[model samples]
Target: MDEGCDGTGLCIDTGDGEFMEISLHSRNSFERKKNPSQDSGFEDRGSKSKKKGLSVSDFLTRNLFSRKAKESEDDAEQGWKLFGRIPPKQAPDKDPQQITQEFQNKLRSVAQPKNSKKSDIEVMSTTALILENRPQNLPTKDPEEAEKHRQQYEAMVEAARKKELKELKMKKKQKQQQLKNEDKVVCAAKRWTDEILPNWETMKSQKKTRELWWHGIPTNVQGRVWQLAFGNDLNVTNELYEICCSRADDRIRMTIESSEIYGNSETSSEPPSSKESSVELIKLDVSRTFPQLCIFQKGGPYYDLLHSLLGAYACYRPDVGYVQGMSFIAAVLLLNMDVADAFVCFANLLNRPCQVAFFRVDEELMKVYFHTFEEFFDENMPGLYSHFKKHKVTPDLYITEWIFALFSKSLPLDIACRVWDVFCRDGEEFLFRTALGILKMYEDLLLHMDFCNLVQLLTKIPEDISGDTLFKHIDTIRMNIDKKRFNQVLAVNKES
Candidate 1:
């Protein structure tokens, strides 16, 4: 027998010198010969009357052998597709089983050597045969469905981007709104300068003017408003400030020279007067005041201004003299106004009756203030009031520093300014009210704290307290201080 195969299918030869082809290319490869016995030289085994398709065993027997016995081994092997070009890739749409079976049959047709015995060939698994014969480019998913998923993912990303952009836009809009409110405040100040101040006797009595001051003096006009509030009743002027500053400079220079010569103690055997003590105190406290701000340190921008202001005030008012907390008041004023105006305001501020009594450490006036505050505290927040009494926590511990500095030390700078606004407008009564408001605001927290914690909390008040929230509680409090008694106490102290 002879055997060969082209890429299409197998071919075989029997001793009759004729060839038969079993084409596997497609259905067209199955065209029958006119006379099967003559054309392919195969004996016609089936009866002509039957005319049925060949069974697998009969088909194999007839197709495996042909009469082309003279064909060379190379020629026969040349048509064998098992050793030919790579198999065509299976079409993505073709039935997988049909393709697998086709390749399986094609792989089973290789010829054996003439000397070797023919053993049955065991065909490989359908998956292995298909993988070996077919190219590795089969599609794992439908093309249209993959495109749909890609578009969906892009849409989700775009939506997230839009959401992020929207949030940014809202934040920017809120910031713009804040700026607009600030502009309104600036515009209101302009009206105060151009319209209101010229007719102050009339404008001062108006409800609108009172309301404006209640909100705040705008930052640009704070110096003017402060000067207006405290008034230059003593006719203090730029020239007087210069003269006082000149006098102060001389005293400070002499003191420094004396300290160098006599090692800090005064050369005179007599005790140092308030004037001598004040100059040294002013120099010592200048660096310590507002140390965190850096503007009051030795080499700071406002250092000379603060030093000069305190020195001038101490020299300008030898009667009131300089106290421990005086620099805090002077420093706060210097921040808002020019040196001359700040000195004028500082003199008038300290001249206020309550300020005089407090700075002088008038025992009688302080007792009155402490007594009044205790009454207000008991009235406003009885629970916290009882707690403080139990712990021996008294107003003298905290309110003294608060009122002395006008809360410039106890509260945040901005909130202290708000307190100052009301203090300037409503007078010392608001100070007592503010103390009550603070106690009421932290009543719950204070009620639970022990003695040390209570003292610490009230003295070193936390910086995080909200000004708005505190004032909201403050507005609700209706404190009725005994103004007549406070005045009598302050007046009696001043006379002595």
Candidate 2:
């Protein structure tokens, strides 16, 4: 065992109570920058020059060597003394167990640093070599003591891990705030908002303000901004939504209660066009929508809000009625604004130029979307397009959810929110750009994936990545797409 071997970390006690080993992991809200200065602890280990900013004792502890290393004939070549391993001998006639217990006691007393500064990094890095050489368990397999040691080590490690997480999150938040401060959009949004939407209408009428949306909308104002962008003032009023809800409630009750008696069977998932069948389908799906999000849980007010919004839309637009994907769409809206506003937003999104065709039982327009996407995919990403085609994988199989739900189910919520910010600004065209952008961002990974693995990878929500990073990816690929070609495909598909 090394001089100060604790269960998890090697601790050194120079008779004083302070411990030399420190944990490297820390906590934060966002990922820390992966610069070499932040990630690795030790660098240039083989260099002959002395490590700067470390005391003599610190240097010796960092550069300690085993007997084999000390015996190297090249000691003169390295020009550094290597401490030989201690012999099997008594420590001043003291019991080894007492000394071991006292060493652990000293380590426990050594407090963790308040902040993880550069100096702390250097200190923590010194322990890296010991971490690799550290034993998994005590040589003595005393079950009880080993278990106790394991528990203590785990507790310490866990605490350090959590602290490290907090640090990383703080770093991420600071970076974002710094970036946000630099963004001129924040100033424009504030000025425009202070002037109110009436004054902003000057810009809107001229069709100049839509570009402000791609710059990032403040969270508090995004709902209203979207409302303004969509020209949705009707559902913003409470009375209108109330009327829709009243009418919808009656339709919903009748459809649900008489579902079995009517042609709309409870088990049927057939293409639903009638208000009654749509209501039945909506009821069946209401509980299942965003099941994991706390706000949309079974009995929450947000849950009731989702029901009201979707139901109101069903009554308001009996032609489209309730669709399978509308629940997630409605959920996203309710998250952004009040139930009434969300309804208006939902209605506007569905009513956009050709989007309503997506819900038709025939699915003819949805097929157009899929076909156009495949065409664009071929033109832009020929390699991935060929791979997907070879495996008989089509956009209709997976992209239906993405298109209908505005990618609510496909991306992490943060990334999805950022996508929505741009989607509202750019209109329906942005959706395809984003879809292709996502593909382009991970093209290398996609190229290596098998068909089933590719499907799984595409469908699963990725881990919490920085939203700014994804938007950067979206922005890069968004410019490369030929809008002229896209319009041509749309025209051809619509004509067909």
Model 1 TM-score is 0.62
Model 2, residue 49: distance off in Å is 88
Residue 177 in candidate 1, Cα distance off native in Å: 5.1
Q: How big is the positional error of residue 120 in model 2, measured in Å on the Cα after superposition? A: 6.0
Alpha-carbon lDDT of model 2 = 0.66
For model 2, the stretches where C-alpha displacement exceeds 4 angstroms are 1-189, 195-198, 204-212, 233-238, 255-276, 478-485
Q: lDDT winner among the candidates? A: 1
Let me know the TM-score candidate 2 reaches against the reference structure: 0.60
The TM-score leader among the candidates is 1
- Give lDDT tens digits, candidate 1, residues 17-42: 44454544433222332334444554
lDDT of 1 at 256: 77
TM-scores of the models, in the given order?
0.62, 0.60
Q: Candidate 1: list runs displaced more than 4 Å.
A: 1-177, 269-276, 481-496
